[model samples]
Target: MAGTTGGAAATAPGKKGETPAATRSGALKRLPLALLVFFAALLYSQIQPPPSKVPGAPGGPPVTAPRTRLRDGRHLAYLESGVPKEEARYKIIFVHGFDCCRYDVLNVSQGLLQELGIYLLSFDRPGYAESDAHPARTEKSIALDIAELADNLQLGPKFHLIGFSMGGEIMWSCLKYIPHRLAGVAILAPVGNYWWSGFPADVVEEAWYVQFPQDQRAVWVAHHLPWLTHWWNTQNLFHSSSVKGKNPIILSKEDTALSQKFLDRTYKEQVRQLGEHDSLHRDMMVGFGKWGWSPLEMENPFAGAGDEVKVHLWHGVEDLFVPVQLSRYISKKLPWVIYHELPTAGHLFPAADGMPDVIVRSLLLGDE
Candidate 1:
């Protein structure tokens, strides 16, 4: 200003001897604020809340079985419903599908119990909600776990098993390793072994999840880099088609509503716990990997044992997640399986109105 220069002369770096000390002082004054911001970000990253629950989520009624400590030093959580009377027709164990917990089958159990008076025991698979993770779990190991669970609950030598979707793999394992402990097996829209040949090319192409980009990526990760599968699941970076294929095969409006209800219930249960991704990843690995045994290689437990230990396979011809072709392949390999292919059903056929009654009547009560 004395030389009539612009205002920059006063603030310009090193112009009027604005020293490094001034800059240092300025940074020092900001140190506390900087530290506060850094720590705030660190805490936010570490303590982020879980995703919000889905609106109108169909939560199951209160759980009954409660958690029990298994002999292997792991916790097994389960829900028991229906009449537990000694004269109950069948003590059925319900194994839920992929990405689902024990509560997924509650509605089905309620329907069966109300109509047929069957006893139902639905347990969370290892690595699922409230149950301890089994990092090294194999199909055979799961079968043994079921046997131990039965023994712990004192369900006697044999009990009926109902496996839905991915749960069917465990049912197959039981057929292979613990046939003597099973009264019967029922699989609904079960995923087939990847190594099993005869998947129709057209069917595979039509299944939406098979072609969906996210699902393809997830499946690739699940097969090759299984350790990343859990992260992938937790990120919600995948999609599985809820409908049949490109088209809808639902029978009525009520069936459609019921399917939505089941899907909502399943979604709520999946996010109810922290380690659901672990179960999901484990399921994918076991399904895509070498199943401990094959139905083709194993002897039919009901070969000469009458209808007590029969295997029943129920699938919708339009199933997208597990194509009916897979079920057909299984039936061909194990010709003794009682296979039913509903023409107008889809992947959610089990949850369709009145289907639960049909399943219970046919599988547990031995009705035609």
Candidate 2:
């Protein structure tokens, strides 16, 4: 009887079954909560202002330079600093790194500027702030834009270039495309090419983020959902104190204070424009993606002119973001790069006390 079913079993409800009404009731009970959450998220998104749109917000410094039209009709915003009359001496055009704008280099000490006797220029690369997005922008295309900007500003036939962090990629492109236009090139804590071989054994070991997905989630988001990347950066503003915790040894008291001042002025200002997100997205995409050219393909432009264009590579030995070994590899590959590996320094050292002066002076004023 227990094992077998009677004729009545055929008409009975299936074993362990709940009535259809009960299932429908359960879904109905959960519906209100789901709707509540949906509407809450919708409201938050609607009311929350974009990071760039907020007034007196924390980001980069405000745009102080006039926006000029390039040959392609896109607007290129730039800041010109230093003695305008000193233009006869080689000009310095600064290329900013991730999350930075033209204002990044504006904080260089007044004493240093007066001492160097060099004209300084910095501009928003395509898409970072006020600069128009170039959807087809490659590293070489960016070089072309710089060439156009150089011509527009009448910066002579050549100028010294300083590329910081991710900006180094564009600097590499400049070397390939417009070497003749450069008086010298300097890279500070530059991002290394992924395709380059002979990476130090410790590179993979030291670069824990490369192995850990959670650590690199922000970068992943920047590559996939740039809007979210902008929102995250906006919500979590940069503070020099943040660096203090992570890099205790790298920043001295003077360096920390200078860094704080620099961040206070430039961080919020860099992201004030709506186009910043687009620019940041493009930078990440082009930086990690195929560069469309190789550093090996480039020849020293000054070689033919009977002079060697100075190449300076400065990297902090303790840099966790970009391994120092990469710089070592790059120096070896290029052979001509004058590499400076600071033992007590980290990635942020370039922006630290006396370092900016050192960088500008070493290139402009020479070792003297």
Backbone clash tally (model 1): 0
Q: Give a tens-digit lDDT track for model 1, residues 1-368.
A: 56656545555654365665686787889999999999988756543433322212344223334776777887677888888846567788889887777877735646558667788888888877666677778878888888888888888888989989888767888887888888888888887665534445554454534434655665666667665655555553345322211223423443455566755563464434544444666788777665545565665777788756668889877654666776776687678898888886766778766777788778866775
- Per-residue lDDT for 13 in model 2? 47
Spell out the clash pairs found in candidate 1.
none
Report backbone clashes per prediction. Answer: 0, 11
Q: Which segments of model 2 are wrong by more than 4 Å?
A: 1-64, 85-87, 197-259, 266-272, 296-301, 304-308
- Candidate 2 structure quality by residue, lDDT tens digits, 1-368: 74456534543543345555666787889999999999989857843434433212355334455877887877788888887834445588999887777878734677767766668899987766666667777778888898889888888888889998888757788888888788898888887655434455566355534323432554545445544544544453432212212343434443454457555663464553655445665566566555455664455556665545788888877665566766776777776677888886766777766778888777765662
- Evaluate model 1: give its TM-score: 0.71
Q: Evaluate model 2: give its TM-score.
A: 0.70
lDDT values, one for every candidate: 0.68, 0.67
